[model samples]
Target: MSPQQKALVIPKKQGNFELSSRSIPSPGAGQLLVKIQSAALNPVDYKIRDAGLFVTHYPAVVGTDIAGIVEELGEGVVNFRKGDRVLAHGKFTNDFAGFQQYTLTDASFSAKIPSSESFDSAATVPLGLDTALVGLYGDQLGAGITPPWTESVGESKTPIVILGGSSSVGSYKLVKDYGATHFFDRNLSGKQLLAAISKVTDAPIELVYDAISLPETQSVAWELLANNGTLVLTLPASVKEDEGKGRKVIQTFASPHAPQNNELCQSSWAMVEKWLSEGTIRPNKYEVLPNGLEGVIGGLERMKLGQVSGTKLVAHPQETQ
Candidate 1:
């Protein structure tokens, strides 16, 4: 029999999560068997538990933000070796998900965690950054901006607004590092926001990333976006854009496993180690939950209740009893 590992699983669609023993899965080609050290919770996690979105199988394990150590490598793997510390975006498949003590990571989606980063901190990055990357630069599911890594692009002179700058999932501070200036409260009404934006520059809002994407927030983002502009929503777009404004709305799916994101994410993942080490990208602030795998239930509840704010909640799967 294969070795068993503690995992948090939902027994059926929209079922409750419970601690279960699942067999440790071996990695296939281009995959790494990783011993998960940290798993970060996201809004989608709670949604999956409540609505079963994106999950097809019963007794499913979920949670995508993962950080861990490579235990073994499968055939044709060369970028990583045994015992390398890494962070990866977990897939919906139970064997590849992050809710287990051990899971498989595709080599293309995993990155070596730099010495400066910790498992908890690194755990907050994978999903969040991927969403932002796909929203900004992914050709298929995004705004289709030229990736800085792929080509020499000039600084964006137009005012770009990213709603939910402080959300735990995606941190947009990197925009400031390049050329973003001016800050405003996202709570402002659409007209108020438009007025505030007018105070700084008259350039029509060409790009708006509604990372929050709540109905109200989407309304505000759509208000500020000019014709021929692009509005990127992390969630499904709730606002219609055919009001004679050539404004394009793109709902971003950041899964590296998704074919639309594979190439874009691969390009970004290749630079993850360098970006974290050089401070081009930094992890979000996170709070560690207690009681190992069991604690994830309560943490997801807190997230569902809209209680968690600003900080990401992470769990230590190995700490499960």
Candidate 2:
């Protein structure tokens, strides 16, 4: 029998999550077997169980944010080795998901965790950061802006609106650190947001990122967009397109595994270690849950109830009993 590890699995579609034992999977070429130390919970984790949105198989494991140590390396994975501390963007596949004691990570999407960071903090970054990255720079799925890494990308004093609640960390810092000249309360209505934007700059609001992506928020974003502007949404777009205005609404799908995003994410992942070390990117504030994998159930429940706020909830998979 192969070595087994403790995992949190949903037995069937829209089923309850329970602790189970599963074989530790081996890494194939260009992959690394990670002994997961911390797995962060996202709203999508519960949404999957409640709505059966993504998984196609029974007894599925679903988690996307992970930080851990490399247990072994597969062929041609030269950047990592046994015992390296790393963080990765996990996928929907059972073997690659984060809700398990051990999982496999694609080498291109994994980055070494800095010495100054903890596993819990590192675990909060992958999904949120990648969503922002792909939305801002991905030509096919994003606003088609030039990435900051390239010399052609110049600093613009243009006013951009980001629709979401305030977060001192996470995506707030990501946008501000990247370059956001003004900030507005996400609670504002379309008219109020336009007034707020007017106070900041009149540079013609060319870009709006609706991080919330609710119907109400999407309406506000659509209202504020200029002709030929772009609106990036995290959820399915609720606002109708106005064809004559030449505006575009892109509902960003944040996954490194997607073929369209693979190369973009690879470039971003390569910069993650340096970004974390230099404080160019700040991980979300996180609270650690108890009882390891068992505590994830309650965490998901809290998320489903809209109880969690601002901070990310992380579980220690190694502490599973």
Candidate 3:
């Protein structure tokens, strides 16, 4: 039998999560076998628990944010070695999923953790950052903006409003540190938010990144958006895109494995380490859950109930009881 590791798995559709022993998979070409240190929970996790969304296999293991240490390397992979601390964007597939003690990460989807960051902090970034990146830079799946990394995209006098500034994806420190000039309460109603934004800049509110994706938040963002503008959403857009104004609504494709996100992710993934090292990007605030893999179950429940706010929930896989 192959070496085994503990995993938090849903045994069937709408099933409860239980701890089970699963085989530790080997890395194929251009992959790394990672011993997971921390796995962060997202809203999608609870959605999957109730509806089995995107989970095709029975006894499914699912998680998208992982920070760990590289245990082994596959053929044709370079710039990484065994024992390197790394963080990766996991997939829905079992072997690449983050709910296990060990998981496989595509080399292109992984980056070495900087000395300044911890596994817990690094784990908070992958899914959220990728979601924002794809929302802003990916064609069709995103706003299709030209990347600042590719060239000098000059600063705009217009303010880009990002609703839900405290969400896991919205909690992105880059916005506060590098992008935003003003902060507003996320609880503001659409008219209030639009009015506050109008006071900040008269540039027409050309772009809005609605990381919350809730109906109320979407409505506010839509109201604030100007003609020929773009609205980026982490979830499906509930707002209708009326014809002729040239406004586009994009549902961000967060997965690194998606072909539409490939080019944008690759270019950005290469800069992750540098971004962290230089403090250009910062991880979200996170709370460590108890009981390792078992703790993640309750974390998902809190997320489902809207009990968790302004913080990312993370679990230690090695601490599984």
Residue-wise lDDT of candidate 3 within 38-154, one digit each (tens)? 999999988888987888998999999999999999999997999999999999899999999999999998999999999999999999989887887788688777878988988
Estimated TM-score per prediction? 0.97, 0.96, 0.97
| Superposed model 2: Cα runs more than 4 Å off | 165-179
Q: Order of candidates by lDDT, top first?
A: 1, 3, 2
Model 1, 1-321: lDDT tens digits are: 999999999999999999999899999999999999999999999899888899998899999999999999999999998999999999999999999899999999999999999999999999998998888888889888888888888877867788887785447443456345777886799999999999999989999988889999999999899999999998887888785878889998989899988888889999999999998888888999999999999999998898987789999999998
Candidate 2, overall lDDT? 0.88
Model 2 lDDT tens row, 73-188: 99999999899999999999999999999999999999999999999999999998898889888988988778887556666777667777443222653355655556677677
Scored against the true structure, residue 291 in model 2 reaches a CA lDDT of: 97
Q: Which candidate ranks first by lDDT, i.e. highest?
A: 1
Scored against the true structure, residue 304 in model 3 reaches a CA lDDT of 89
Candidate 1 residue spans exceeding 4 A from truth? 173-179
